[model samples]
Target: MAVRKLEHVGIMVKDLDQSIPFYTEVVGLKHQYTMTHTNGIIRLAFLAGADAQESQLELVEGYEGELAVEGRTHHTAFTVDDVEAEFARIKQLGVPLRDTEITTLPNGARYFFFYGPDGEFLEMFQPAPGR
Candidate 1:
């Protein structure tokens, strides 16, 4: 069968403890469960939004540092309702942003990037209509 939807997005973090709160509070994702890799010193935490149909956010820890030298990109962006409001809320938390302004899409979506507590890049945005 063909793919129906994206299942989840995986993020690599330096520490789960530091990254978890931002996902739960700022991004507002709910923790589902965690798993410890049998063959490595890695941990995985899967989180979901209120709408279960959407994909989950998986946080991977312990596979970072100097060993992870390649392949991991900067960050990933997820859909949001009001990017401006979300920016205001997160800015109030005093998290130093990697960039201080919002990026605009050709279709009018507003967005920006910031680092999570674990220093992982995270992008949030509000999409334009028909986008």
Candidate 2:
């Protein structure tokens, strides 16, 4: 048996229309598609980066529960080419940022945090060269 790769990360949201644009336009992901769950009460939207081989982000809406600051999922991170540039772009969008500035890890990786439309935690990660 083998696990090839992570399929996607599911994030609970309050609305699809708002979250879709945020993930697409703001986060730089493409809306692969949107569908309704078999239960008929829940709606789901799948998004991915320009590279289809990458894992996707599944946005679940219509769930009857509180979207706590700390939910079942901690946070969803996106791989970015330039952490500083992305941070500046997000800042210009007036999005609520969790980090005052980009952080550099011991391995030379960099990242920053921010909130989504539904108050979900999100991050932009840039790996060190050749990582």
Candidate 3:
């Protein structure tokens, strides 16, 4: 069977309250909804883009262990109008950045990496205009 589309990316976070603001305020995603498991062991918050068609970011709370190393590379990137402006905004927030400066590709795609409260890597990308 072929996959249709990516619905969302799940991230196990330590605290939903702390993580939720970052995606909503910094990443510019809207909080769609939140739910608690029947067992009360897990709580999830769903954040989505302004365009409903875009995939969402799910934040899962109640996990106790360290995030997997693979999680760092398994990052989710959000498209931005300007990578430089986003980078400057993140810098102003005093967030920890994986890259000291933004990087550009031959195709004119620009990006930079940063970490979340749980050390989860996140990227902001700007594709070449008119492409």
Candidate 4:
């Protein structure tokens, strides 16, 4: 089967109260809606950027401590026009970055990683021209 675009990235957060504001205000995402699972074991808050059709960021709750493996979940990357400017903005916001310098992948994509409110890894990428 052919894979379509990504639907959403599920992230487990300690508290939805704080995570919601961070994603909306800091990350510049729009809050769509929230809903709990049928079994009531988890609650999810879906968020989207200006383009609602793009992939979404799902803030998940009630599953803390269960998935604590680093590098396993890895990161979720968002495309940007200028990686440097975005890096500066994130720094100006007092967010800690994974590295002091941006790295260019073999495919010529520049990116940097940072930790989220719940210690999840997040990345910002800028692909090469014509990519």
Candidate 5:
């Protein structure tokens, strides 16, 4: 019940080498870091403005699907104090979920995907301490 703030918005990209620079240089955002998903498929890169504490942009690469030119957003994540709690609560409410279990990233952050009213991807994310 305590969704704190917007965590990040994920955008599907064909190449991180190209998207990373575009967001950092052209968009005037700072590249925070990059990491590969635990699934060993998707590559993720985060970017932020002057305030790293705020919401960020995530560039996702290695998706084996067609990327739409207009709507490239992959998912929208919201910061949660407890991802597990939220996941349970959402399930109890009968919300459609994309992930059966929470996914732990290399950085220790945990997240799970759920479907919104329109079938758009939404995430409940609990960031690792100090992140």
Candidate 6:
């Protein structure tokens, strides 16, 4: 019918191995799979929520040198049903990531940040429905 759900978030990471734990431990998610499309062109890792589906995090590594620096972008925030646990877990990780200065959104959504090898804002927010 319509769109099933979010597929995955594509991130450009300087290193794949380094960002694994952040998604695994900090976010309390699992690495669904990893792949290399070419010898030194494209590499990726996919992460999914522990209790949910239809959405995943894609960590793309191996875009080295300056070719990967063209129009770089920022991190993304995934909506969650619970903010306390999400915010706490990310802070507990101690990963080098920046966010909206601090967690807690205007709509009472809570969030935090963590970098993926390269310094970028990876945000996670939990919002109450019917807001």
**What are the per-residue Cα lDDT tens digits for candidate 4 across 37-131?**
54467776879998787877878788644654553243576778788888888989999888798877544657777889987778776755775
lDDT for position 41 in model 6: 70
lDDT of 6 by residue, 6-72 (tens): 3446677778888888879887889877776434476767788886555677787876534346544
Show model 4 residue runs off by greater than 4 Å.
69-131
lDDT of each: 0.69, 0.78, 0.74, 0.74, 0.92, 0.61
lDDT of 1 by residue, 1-131 (tens): 12234545667787899888888999998987776754358786878898755777878787653535473443566667777776777798897687688876444656777779888767675645764
Question: Positional deviation of 27 in candidate 6, in angstroms?
Answer: 1.6
Measured with C-alpha atoms, the lDDT of residue 117 in candidate 6 is: 64
The true-versus-predicted C-alpha distance at residue 17 of model 6, in Å, is 0.7
Model 5: which ten-residue window has the lowest total lDDT? 63-72
- Candidate 6 lands at a TM-score of 0.46
Clashing pairs in 2: none
RMSD of each: 13.4, 13.5, 14.0, 13.1, 1.0, 13.5
Candidate 3 per-residue C-alpha lDDT over 4-38 given as tens digits, one digit per residue, 9 for 90 to 100: 34545668787999999998999999998777744
- Please name the candidate that would achieve the greatest TM-score relative to the true structure: 5
Q: Is candidate 4 or candidate 5 better by lDDT?
A: 5
Off by over 4 Å in 1: 64-131
Task: Write down the TM-score of every candidate.
Answer: 0.47, 0.53, 0.50, 0.51, 0.96, 0.46
Native RMSD of candidate 4 (Å): 13.1
Count of clashing pairs, candidate 4 = 0
Alpha carbon lDDT of residue 84, candidate 3?
Answer: 86
Q: Runs in model 2 with CA error above 4 Å?
A: 72-131
Please give, for residues 16-80, the per-residue lDDT of candidate 2 as tens digits.
99999999999999998787765578887878889867778879888776655777454577777
